[model samples]
Target: MNSVSRRKFFGLMALGAGSMAMLPGMAFGAAKAKTSAPGQTSLAAGQAMARIKALIDELRAEGRAFAADALASDNNAQWDRLLNHYFDRKGFASISVNAANLCPSLKPVNRMAALVRDLLEADISFPMRGELAKASLGHGLTAVKDWFGLGGSDAKADFLLALTANSTMGNNFVNNGLVTSGFMDPQKDNIVVWDVNHPTNYDAWMYRKATQGWGADSIRILKTKMFASSVTEAERKAGTIPSDPQNEDEIIAALLALVDERTKLVTLSWQSNECGMVLPMQRIVSELRAVNKNIHIHADSAQTFGVLDLKLGQVDVDSIAGSFHKWPCGPKMVGILYMNNKHGAAERFTPSIWGYDEYINTPADYGFAASTGTIDPNAKRFSYLGQQNDATLVATWMAALFHTGQLHPGVTPAKIEARIHYLGGQVQQALFKHLPKVFPDFTPKTAAQWIATPTSNARLRSSVYLFKTPDGIVAGDVMKHVYEQHRFAIANLKVMGHDLLRVSPTICNNAKDVEDVVAAVVDVILAMKKKTLANNTHTRSYA
Candidate 1:
């Protein structure tokens, strides 16, 4: 079963237990039979069916009432309403069509739905990240070679390491077998390991700081940051800069300063919150090249991928790692890594099990050789196929074809981004109209503003709109209420160290979906208000 189904099953079990406790008379027990005959099995079966139908009817009625309340009360602060009320219908339709197109081996009908749920429920963890690495190892290495201007034997060795690293689980295979063997050591530390300075730098600092007798003098740290100096003229004119400096140049400069030459350096950047955030990565790339050609530039464009049309050549980026599932809405297993020709530090430093002598300086043989056996067995195991691989493949291909055909590659990302932005604006407008009645002084200006109100910016992505309820309601509880009550499946953004309802609209959704989700959120908020008032009265009476 998919994660969502498992959750639902658990919910039902809990609810049934709770209901039994609340109403002991309705608890499971022997019931009176109409026939009063021991052999009347058929009659018993019919009676059981009738009971089941009645239960279903009751649930349906409850669901209708709940949905109506959501629409009438204007509680758009909940996650379930955002997901189920808005896009669930279209998603269900797509899933149904995809399931039918799938092969018979898999329980196509349920399989498609399960896959969809799995995709939604999948955790953003190392396992998922590793899967992405496994799938794009070869491509990443190739991009590195292309970016770094590596050629001849050097390029050939780099390709081999790429293959080995792709196939292997760790860098040991590449380091010992490739670098120590003296077959690929020439390019070690020269390719400039390009990566965003995130948890990597933070982790490294934490580790170093934790070490006993560690001093600043012991480490030669050069802080060269890459950032925009100020917000752009347009952003200033638009009055978009609220608090933070939106210039990419200053941001990059700050990032560059944080880089310590004692170890590998990674630079990080986020999408421009204001229109003027300019990334000086291209300039940084150029400066680093002129100063030291060996530096490898790893770019993490996970946040910027679909929103921006990146000019790979202009930026002089050596290696790039991105999450496809985020903005692209592609298969969960997919991600992209671009590397320059000269950037083969990992392969040059890490070696494979096979001796380096067997593989020569050639892209084809070395390319496949480097990454032939490192993939984790469990990484691809338990795919949410549910036995319908063929139908799934066809459906996935069809979705790609349909979306790409209609949207076009060059235009798809931009168009979808714009639409999401507009939808977010609409949601904000709706929230402003409803939130103040329940939450006075509730002025949600932008998606970022809403998420940041509770310092949820670290966890919530730009694509999602998230906000906390005034009464501190858990996002999961609100999500359940919305889905079970409205047949919608809005998701919660869990990364920001706290729970908040997330509103994410993809190509499958339109303005109506956005509005519906907003309406549902409003309903949730109103319901919360009612519950609070009732609880307050009860407390007063007790006192």
Candidate 2:
């Protein structure tokens, strides 16, 4: 991975965030415990689960000891006493010891208690279980207070819609369906609901279940592919599919045409395109607010949780949802949601199947709402070798604290985004120069140039650079050429209507990495060109 050039980063950027798993020698595949098929016993899975449980129990004990040791070292400091009171921890005056070991810069007095809290949190942050628990608690509490004002109400609002789709989680807002629907009703303090997006698609299926609309149509909008009022017999014969964000907007527009404004919108956003483009939710919210004053915006930042600086409350984002395992390195399945006090109940959108406690009349009313029965009892749930949700949540919280300490304050989501974009642009340039020989149209185009076409400009620049090759050249051809022949890491791009080579870069990518990828792409294009020329010559001679 070292000595790689910026060009290689471009290649990675094309693959987008979703393509992270496909990288060479750094496959993001989950190391699930080897298990037997459904009919066979899963001894391996069982063992893995047992091991994880044992580790969790040990960590819990360690955490307790650490708390006690820190408290005991406090030396009867009044500040330590206050923290114990506020946080409700029974351990001795641990604040003094924590101040001594964790952060010495602080005065160690009452004024520095917050710093101590942050530091102790940082120390315990490595194992995600506890941290993730905090996140879940935060989300739950925010849900209650945001939806129902400061007091619990017996009256329930009309809807509790959760909109999630694509990078909605990254952007921390429900932009897809909520924005597409045209009326932002969630923010007006009426309903106890939340709009969220998973990095994976979750809400679309829920929508299908609720609306009884065509599933293909729903997916087509999210993928941003082909667009038609209806897939005609001829179009089906031709193998058309909607695969662009604009197509999604069109689908939304269509849905809006027939649906009522009162209809609630919920969706999950992830892997919309290989570009791995995160949602620009704050901007979307601003735009949405102009049209609908009441629209609530609850975003899912599962992928961007610890990696990106998300001031959800400051940005007027009502609620935020996220899973801990992806970037923050927290325990698996740990997710959190942040609620903005200003947005109020328009952001509380819990699933109805999850039994609603009478105490949770709205989002702004309470800190805890014990609603259960939301998930399928027998269905597959979030588990990394059977780790318990509580433990996982804690681990995620620790990861967040650890990563937050590591990142430079200057680094923002916008910066990471620019870096990836720059890498993708460079790769596209290299490919444009090299691929001319193989396919006449192998000219690499910038995301701007490719997406700027009449149909794409109004939409996002597919986070991955999408360049069209010759009409007949399928995405698989380019993918195979890069991965097998050239050994350059890249992914197939079949987003919207364009066949593109998607490259994506993440925090791990640097300028050199980008160059290595581009150089390989250059070589592949040259070889392909030579082969194309030979084939053409042979065809001419035969004719």
lDDT of each: 0.35, 0.34
Q: What are the runs in model 1 whose C-alpha is more than 4 Å off?
A: 1-246, 260-263, 267-295, 342-413, 427-438, 444-450, 453-462, 493-498, 532-543
Q: Which candidate is the best by TM-score?
A: 1
Model 1: weakest 10-residue lDDT segment is: 95-104
- State the lDDT at 396 in candidate 2: 35
Candidate maximizing lDDT:
1
- Per-residue lDDT of candidate 2, residues 26-68 (tens digit): 2123445454467743234223223333333343343333233
Cα-based RMSD of the predictions, in order? Answer: 18.7, 19.8
RMSD of 1: 18.7
Using all chains and alpha carbons, the TM-scores for the candidates as numbered come to 0.46, 0.45
Q: Write the per-residue lDDT of candidate 1 for residues 1-543, one digit (tens) a residue.
A: 554454344334333323222111122333443452764323332232233223323433433433332221122333234334323454352211010011111122133334333432443232222222221222223332332223232433223222211111221221123224333223222112222223332234334334423344332232221121234544433322222233334333443443334323333333321111224567767755554565545555544544343556456665444433444443333333334433543432322233311111112222333355432111111111121222122222212221222112222333444544445555556656665665665554333334322111221123344455556555555555555555455654443244456555544444566667667766765675566322121111000
